[model samples]
Target: MILFCPPGVYRAQSDTELLAGRLARHAAGRDVLDLGTGTGALALAAWREGAASVTAVDLSRRCVAATRLNCLLHGAPARVHRGDLFEPVATRRFGMIVANPPYVPSETSVLPRHTPGRSWDAGPDGRAVLDRVCDGAADHLEPGGVVLIVHSQVCGPEATVERLERTGLTADVVERARIPFGPVMRSRANLLERRGLIEPGDRLEELVVVEGRRG
Candidate 1:
């Protein structure tokens, strides 16, 4: 599917597609939420998968506009909102929530305040946004609802599962893939190695989809 990603809006990458594929398997006739919905890729995928409705939320205005355009282009019935994760849909609940948030371990403790890096940099441990998503998902999920999130193993998938579990959701790693380092990971290889997050000469990273279900 063709998508319009203006400068600074993240294009759907491996993580996005991975989560989308998993979402497709269960989204049929369900209300779906796509957090950090860059380019509306996952939202559009959910719609195509027969979701009853799809609501996409992103913190970036560019992403919001891009998602809106993509939805219109495909005639998908999706509502796009510009806001921080979960905030725009605080009063709404969905059968499924999917996100491919930033999980690239960075050199600094602080996440990017502004710039294209905001699309992928997730602070030093790469769990800044991931943690927020995990901690807040259960509140917006319907009973028996599922939350699918994809991120690098370097960001600590176990922690994500634990966080969701603490929020009273049954969580597990549903999928895993070993993919070559992308541009951001490649550029941070040295730092990652120094931090012992990856071994020397490691050019590949494992991505995992963490699934959390509200009971």
Candidate 2:
């Protein structure tokens, strides 16, 4: 499916994005929710994979508008929502939840603003948004449904796994390891260390794909 993405839209150009597409392939015809649906990348991908319905949510008005336009462009059945986390879609549930939320440490000043590239900042410690996502996911997922999240190991992959487990969700690393730093990926280590978001002895890694399932 083709999406007319705008500038500053954080389009996924990594293996984790590919993992999302692959997950969609394995779960075709399921109802899907794409959180932080910037440019409707994963949302459109799920639609292309035959998801019966696709709902996209993003905090950015530009992102919502772009997602709607992209859905129309691809003739995909996607509803775009403008709100934080899962607020707009509270009354609904889905068989699959896919997100590439902002996972960069707030100490890193490389994130794009809400107007343009608000897709990579995860407040302090880089788990701000991700924590919220994990905390709220169980409520929105149907029985035996899956929540697929794409984040960086720099954002604490093991911590994310633990968080999901504590939230009553079983989690695993679908894909992991270091990838090249984009313009946004730069300076995370230094900034995080400087701000104490990461300790000197911390084993900070790069990027990974985290997948969790609601039991």
Candidate 3:
């Protein structure tokens, strides 16, 4: 599949592919909502998986444009919206919601709004965006709906499960993959080590998929 990622939009990465793999069997006949639909990669995946309908949301205007073009190019029927997480779809609910959000721990508490850092910086603990995904997902989900979110272990996958559970959803880690450090992770290896998020000289990180179901 071909996707166009604008200059400032985030391109699909390993985690995107990982989460997308689970969509094949689950998305068919379901109305899907893709949060943080960078490049519309996951949105297209859901469409390809036979989703009944697809709606995508992104915080970056560039990403929204990128997703729109990619979906249009592929003839994937998806409604692309620009707004913060869950903001664009406040009055809507879906059968399935998927996200591959920023979970990289960064040096600063404030997130980048204009720089390339906007694509991956997730504040000090990397939950700045992750928490919102977990916290607000339940309210936006239909009865017995599923939300699948992927992120690195550095941000605490267990916490995602717990947070989702607190919202009256049954949540658990559904997928796990050990991948070597990417460019961002490699660059921040030292800081991660110093912060004890990673052991000395450890350059590998595990990405986990947390599946939450509203009951």
Q: Which candidate has the highest lDDT of all?
A: 1
- Give the candidates in order of lDDT, highest first: 1, 3, 2
Q: Residue 164 error for model 1, in Å? A: 0.5
Q: How big is the positional error of residue 142 in model 1, measured in Å on the Cα after superposition?
A: 0.5
lDDT of each structure?
0.93, 0.77, 0.92
Query: What is the Cα-based lDDT of residue 11 in candidate 3?
Result: 84
Report the CA-based lDDT of candidate 3 relative to the real structure: 0.92
| 10 residues in a row with least lDDT, candidate 3 | 17-26
lDDT of 1 at 82: 88
Q: What tens-digit string does per-residue lDDT give for candidate 3 at 41-105?
A: 99999999999999999988889898988998999879999999899889999999999988899
- RMSD, candidate 1, Å: 0.8
TM-score of 2: 0.86
Worst 10 residues of 1 by lDDT: 105-114
| lDDT tens per residue, model 2, 1-215 | 45677776776678446556557644587899988888888888888788888899988877888889988877877888889878999998999898888887765445555444367776767777888888898899998888887787667788888888888889998776556566665556667667765566555455677788888
What tens digits encode model 1's per-residue C-alpha lDDT throughout 7-46?
Answer: 8889898888789889988899899999999899999999
TM-score to true structure, per model: 0.98, 0.86, 0.98
Number of clashing residue pairs in every model?
Answer: 0, 0, 0
**After best superposition, candidate 2 residue 29: deviation in angstroms?**
2.0
